[model samples]
Target: MFLAIRELAHAKIRYALIGLIIVLIASLIFIISGLAKGLSADNASAIQNMKADYILMDTDAELEMTKSFISRTDLDNVLQMDGIEQANSLSVRMMNASVNGSDQNEDVALFVTDGDSMLLPSVRDGSPITQEDEAIVDASLQREGIEIGDRLVFGEESELTVVGFTDSQRYSHTPVVFVDGGGRETINAIAISVDESRADEIRNAVGNSFDMVTKDEALKGIPSYSQEQASLNMMIVFLFVITAFVLAAFFYVITLQKRDQFGVLKALGAKTTYLAQNLVGQVVLISIMCIGIAMGLTLGIAELLPEEMPFLLTADEMVQTSILILIVSIIGAFLSLIQIVKIDPIEAIEGAGK
Candidate 1:
């Protein structure tokens, strides 16, 4: 890598541009990953925030909660099981929300559940939305400048009062608003707290009959969850692959430019294996720098956005994604190693434009 570093230092502009591209590309990978994760979390947060071990959804419905429906009968059968402590129903809907008549309306995901449960978490403002005129909004939504006691229009037609707020219970990429059960009786699904053995039994008995799932599986029930997640993930995977090819191609070109240097080193008794390893090592160094800058940039950008932005970065996921990008970036450079070992000293020195 000494040779590669020396070459990069001497041609800093060219190398820096490549590194910048790598940085931008890696940042994009991470930003999209953050967005994907944020979207997943936003869409699934209500379910994720559930204090339950299991969530039951409509069997005929795919994995999305938006498409699911549960009956009072469905509710009763589960309650009858031993070790199954309790269950609560939820209704989900997407609605248009506007504050103070500004062009600032946003889509809010409606979480229709009894507000009295611990599963709903605590309030950030006003009070728990225990009544029809009362509703608890997520803090992320409240940060949009609407506040406690302010009103938000729901659906294509009218509005509902913002009685209180909570940071918990986000669903399908929108902040959650908890309302009374009467708001939407065709409740979307149910959250169930169960013993491990009971979960298995319930899963086997009623699940096989009515078609239900745990929380994770219920995410697939969202109308757009599976398709959108799969599409975005495919793009991320392809982008990573393209990044690897581009890095390898850049390094391969760099190696060719340094063929005479490699010949000289070889002529001085350096092993081809050592020289190849050095090239791979250089790629690793550049990849690390690139990934680091990408993360810094993501943090910087997230801060610059308005508070209303749905962008969120989970610490563990961000760390995991960064490592994965670096690993792939290094793999990209390793592909260049093949070119490093193929250089012929005699041919390179003979100057057939080697």
Candidate 2:
């Protein structure tokens, strides 16, 4: 450790450049990971927030809620199944809503279920919807100039009064508008709270026409959710691979520069393990310092972002990714260690035969 520190102090400029590269790569990983998580939450938070453990959809629809259509009879069959506690028919449709007097029409995802259903958002600021044409909307609408008691026209004849707002209840990247009054015809998917032990039995009882899937599984059926996540996750993978290669190359060059020093140390009674430790310790120390700086910068960037732009970095995500960075850095440092071990003390003392 002392030798590693002394070497770093002696070659401050060289190590500083390496540290800068590590910092840039680490920051890219953090930012890209946060965006991946943020986009996922934006696409699925509404379903993720629900208490229901399973979604019952038409089997023919292949787990997609929008493509699935369950009738009143299909819901009844599931309700009668063993271990089922609660079930509610949910309908979602995209519609254009104009603020009472303005020509500006916003596209909103309309959610309709039974008035007394648990699927309804418990109001955060105002009263719950108790009648037809009365609705609760995601809080994001507040940013769009929507206010409580604002009447929104759904169509020429259909209009709704905004009765309440729910916190962050977005679906498929769109703000959700929860309403009442659509009967069996509007039933698209059924949300169910089921006993885990009897989950298989429940699915069997629902028959061949319906499929029951977990909440996360249901989200993958959303058109944009899977594709967006895959592309972003692939970007993160590439960034990690690039970091490994860059660190390996940088450390290899540094090792070459110190070949003579390592040879002298070995001739002076230094063990191969000791030289390896010093080399790896430098890599670890540099990685920690760079990663720490990257974290602080990432938080500052997050604070400056507008709420509409999703960039969520959770504690678990940071911790897990940081561990990965350390591991990959250590792997890269091994390249230097191998060269150190291969050094011949005789040849090193003889000055490379020159």
Highest TM-score, which number?
2
Error of 2 at 86 (Å): 1.2
lDDT of 1 by residue, 273-340 (tens): 88877776777778888888888999998889676555778778778887887788778777567766
lDDT of model 1, residue 55:
74
Candidate 2 collision pairs: none
lDDT of 2 by residue, 70-164 (tens): 78877777778779999888988878899985887888888888888888978898999989889999998999989999988977898999999
Q: How does residue 9 of candidate 1 score in lDDT? A: 81
Name the candidate that leads on lDDT. 2
Instruction: Write down the worst ten-residue block by lDDT for model 2.
Output: 179-188
Mark the regions of model 2 whose C-alpha exceeds 4 Å error after superposition: none
- Cα-based RMSD of candidate 1: 3.8
C-alpha lDDT of residue 254 in model 1: 80
Alpha carbon lDDT of residue 61, candidate 1? 69
Q: Poorest 10 consecutive residues of model 1 by lDDT? A: 179-188
